[model samples]
Target: MSDSREVVRGLLRPQFREATPYGAPQLDVAVALNTNENPFELPLEVAEAVAGALREQVPHLNRYPDREFTGLRKALAAYLQAQTGLSLPIESLWAANGSNEVLQHIMMAFGGPGRSALGFVPSYSMHELISVATGTQWIAGRRDEHFDLTAADARAQVQEHDPDIVFLCTPNNPSGTALGVDVIEAVLAASRGIVVVDEAYVEFVRPGTPSALALLGGQPRLIVSRTMSKAFAFAGARLGYLAADPAVIDGLRIVRLPYHLSSLTQAAARAALEHSDALLANVEELKSQRDRIVEGIASLGLTPVPSDANFVLFGGLSDAPATWQALLEHGVLVRDVGIPGHLRVTAGTEAETTAFLNALAAVQR
Candidate 1:
């Protein structure tokens, strides 16, 4: 109709004019392992419970959902307490459609023109995307050659940038390495503003790794963001939440839209949380498969980084893009994260893992 798309582009913000949306390729492949999603499907009993809960709320669709989502918060608090042995109050919990939205709410409340946020390079892409969208300056800090941050290095970077918000991604994505608590504490001490510890993959962490939730008390500016999408196999449910001080949670409330959570979402999440044990029964199995992938790739002579998360990032490819395409030709899909020789693959069931390994070995030869 008259170059409406061009007209829209001409009126867009300068910073966004050249920006492309963030997403991995969504292709129909025999084995999909790109997005780091939990490979297991929800247990049938849990799914049935979610369906029943949704049906119970269907009649009340005409009414607005509980704006505070009080019940969901209580469930989350209880879940955290049981998981971490931390006595979390309901007021310390907040949730959104997904952790991305939860992050947006934090940015809206604390970030804006003239303020800056800093994050280590090659972490979650969305952290920078959201910062730019909210008009906050995004500062890219460097990580070491191995993608690991030491306490001294982290503190130095934070002190140098003096950003208003600092992001720490544990079990960091695209690399699958978890940060130690000392590194986190060092950054917190160095920065004078908010410190967001993104723990979306925390549930898959190796044994003996501690969660940031244990550091919540007395650190008013610390926020730990988590998601059901990864470990709980609730990616389809779109439920992400954060644990922080009550004051921090209160700030998010000011930025969130009214009744941001729908009745159906609340019901489904609550039902899943009720059967947390059954829902998480496959975690060990996934961990085993993850180990298998590491071993299989290594046996082929590829360099797979030691991973604490459900995905593995490997290097040693002569050309990552070419290998990615070759793997796809074999009906297997993995993530080419723009790193020169690295690609990321999510751990799937034993059969899926076998298919991926076979495809990779064939492609390598």
Candidate 2:
């Protein structure tokens, strides 16, 4: 009789409540490189455009937003074409609240109960959570120290699980190493189902390195998801899109809720697209800063992985949990990667980078 409902819930995924590293901060600090966020504030022009769009619209919170978000989709498609140099039809584009929701749509559309999803270990954590939430099994293949996607290893796992969907997070979340385009093509060629390339950090990479988006035509089963969150300085806006064949987009539409995006969100995203050139310029700056951080970590006798994204993963101290706590005590919050002694730190503003670097030095000493 006492809380029988709560008692009925026998347990939860151990990882769900496993005291993971997130949101640990107290006093206001001048620098915060824990979360991978664009250090630059939104450009004045971009902010004004977003505000102007909202002002032009009649207050219509009473009415739902455009269910399909067609206009915004077209804007995004055009922006992507400019970025990736691929002609993308609006029908080939799908938008969601963020890459997270975009990812969920992919899982819902292709993976379900009894299906399986493939991912690489030490990659994004969301892939596992999304798979579990959708009642699909998540299978991970371990990567070597370099974080390269070994074709042989991937092929063996693909053959074993025959997953309904595969996720490739380029410039991978923790390691920040991007899988080569050729490696990605090989995966799609070998994959028996959909292959999703999450290019959430593409902006930070060098231009010559190809994006998975460039391989869309060569591989019909490929789906490339990008987010405005990191590079655009719009983590708060939460706008993300997936580029795929029209059929793939249509499949996701079947599973998405009506009016998945609010008009304000759509307006903001569209406006943000107008200033992508400026936003990407900041990305170049971040890349330089990231290089500095990586080199600094290595010079300190730590092993820093080669990174092409907004963050870097490094190993120095033997105990990650203790080191993470130590860094926090010094007012530096960082991502505590579950790897034995690894940590991920975002490339923040110059000031933030200095704080992280100084804190790391003090902690290691």
Candidate 3:
């Protein structure tokens, strides 16, 4: 090893020896569907509102924001109440830069050297990454070949590990499997620690699907996290929030930095929350495109995992990496999520989805 490499390795923790920062390819391509982002832009009125909110904050930028983020918390609570009909108090709401940061706060508060976290594999890799980064032991749990977790299996594993934190990702990442409430309840009954339901893509779920937010009442250990990045079409704003018991929010506050949320982020998110109804209209359109990808890939003879998320995880490639490259050559980019014969693609605009389906078909030929 080079002298610089040797010195850095010796200075860092044992886990830091070979860890790479989390990211996907940032290539310039005609179509980008790697990240499961809402493809729609903000409505004109909402954009103007955000700009106006920021303008109002220019004078107050000299002062630190409310350390408690009181106004933003109220806005978030209102938004959640409108969406879920669960009228949680402002004390039960919390916000951070992204869902990832919200999760990091959870880990810092509840997970550490002696404590551990458990998550089903091929789910959100960040659950594992964040666990390790926080000095928490990460236990990789199991999933069936279809990437689905059953209530019985989940209960068995929870009983086995008895970890301090458990992550259950609904409409799970990469595989796009949506766990039923039965599975969530089973895991909760079995785990003695925190249970986080990552609902970053919950907005795109098919009709009649239930959100875990409904389970938050009388469930102090349960946390339901949501992001503006996906359904709200405010990915660029980097706002993610969660609803839990007020006591759980108290634990996060002990770990969060003072004024961790900026005045600008608070302003932008509150403005966005005011026009949330108009912003979320685009969710129906994206859901339409998501279903189209599922059907299109299935008709092309590939296997698509039934998705309630904005992305589709399809299988049947002999070489997923080669197929990903081939699709890129056809001017489309998709995620090769490290599964042996499967890849994931985000649903974009109508033209973007058509381009992906066409490019995928051409590669198969």
Candidate 4:
């Protein structure tokens, strides 16, 4: 074991020799609330439709999938138009296995040695991980104590770094609060590079919160990424997409492996998009439960960061790690997120939420 470990350390890339793979602890618990996944399974009608589409593709598996995923792109464009009221040309759309891959593709094309990527700290950790993985320099900017980014500070950092790529995560992870369009616009106005806005949880955002999709028009360097995982309950389908200028899409096309999206993935995603209305019907319920978590945790004297996404990040824990372990012993799993005094929980089904709150209450006592 010692010799094998030494060999791996010697052979792997210098940066990755000590890096850990990204994932949550896959644990068996009565109620799991980590990872911010939509708690509902697909509606039966949608499931049947996706299965039927995949069934039709089985016989054609011997051939590669449509390299451009034309049909899926059209479906995605229509869905985004209806959802955002922005009619974008299909040429502006692109997809990969997941939103992380979408980020990776952008990095591959635009970010490399000597190119730098800037993201606000305590935002999405993946923004840093993917940047470093692509050999792009990672620059960590700061956020306010409440996890909010001000337009002035955002512009200042962008100007100071002059990064080749800037990442903005709305309704950011680990904190679950959202950014306004002004913040995004400020970054765009300040920087000379590409701006990638990750909206992985937009469907669950509270009312009146605008999306960056509204800003994509006339901004050739802006890329808005979305996922079917959170709202469409299609995480298992591994489909994530983005909208950008046709030129950005073309650049990503150059770096993408041929036939990168599998035939089954494309079919499943399109079928799921066909039922976007039904699949998203539970957003209200999830939002309600998310609010419940905020109130429930606050009622117990823990300060939950206000959330627009389906998860809540709460602080005021005297010892977050101990509380996390206590909740696990009670069969409820949440994320510690490595923050000093905060833990994050996904808003699950009503019953699951109840279990989490109850477990925390017990731990508190």
Which prediction has more favorable lDDT, 1 or 3?
A: 1
- Tens digits of per-residue lDDT for model 1, 182-292: 999999999999999999998889999989998988999999999999989999899999999999988998999989999999999999999999988888888999999
lDDT of 2 by residue, 81-120 (tens): 7876788889889989989999999999999888999898
Model 4 spans > 4 angstroms off: none
Which candidate would rank higher by TM-score, 1 or 2? 1
Roughly what TM-score does model 3 have, to 2 decimal places? Answer: 0.98
Clashing pairs in 3: none
| Per-model CA lDDT versus the true structure | 0.94, 0.83, 0.92, 0.94
Q: Which regions of candidate 3 deviate over 4 angstroms?
A: none
lDDT of 3 at 347: 90
Steric clashes per prediction:
0, 0, 0, 0
State the lDDT of candidate 3 residue by residue for 1-365, as single tens digits.
69998998889899978888899998899999999878788899999999999999989898999888999989888888887788989998999999999999999999989999999998999999999999999999999999999999999999999999999999899887788999999998999889999999888888787899989888999999889999898888999899999999999999999889999999999999999999999888888898999999999999999999999999999999999999999989899899999999999999999999999999998
Each model's TM-score? 0.99, 0.93, 0.98, 0.99
How far residue 31's Cα lies from its native spot in candidate 4, in Å, is 0.5
Better of 2 and 3 by lDDT: 3
Candidate 2 local lDDT, residue 328: 81
Query: What are the C-alpha RMSDs, in order, of all predicted structures?
Result: 0.9, 2.6, 1.1, 0.7
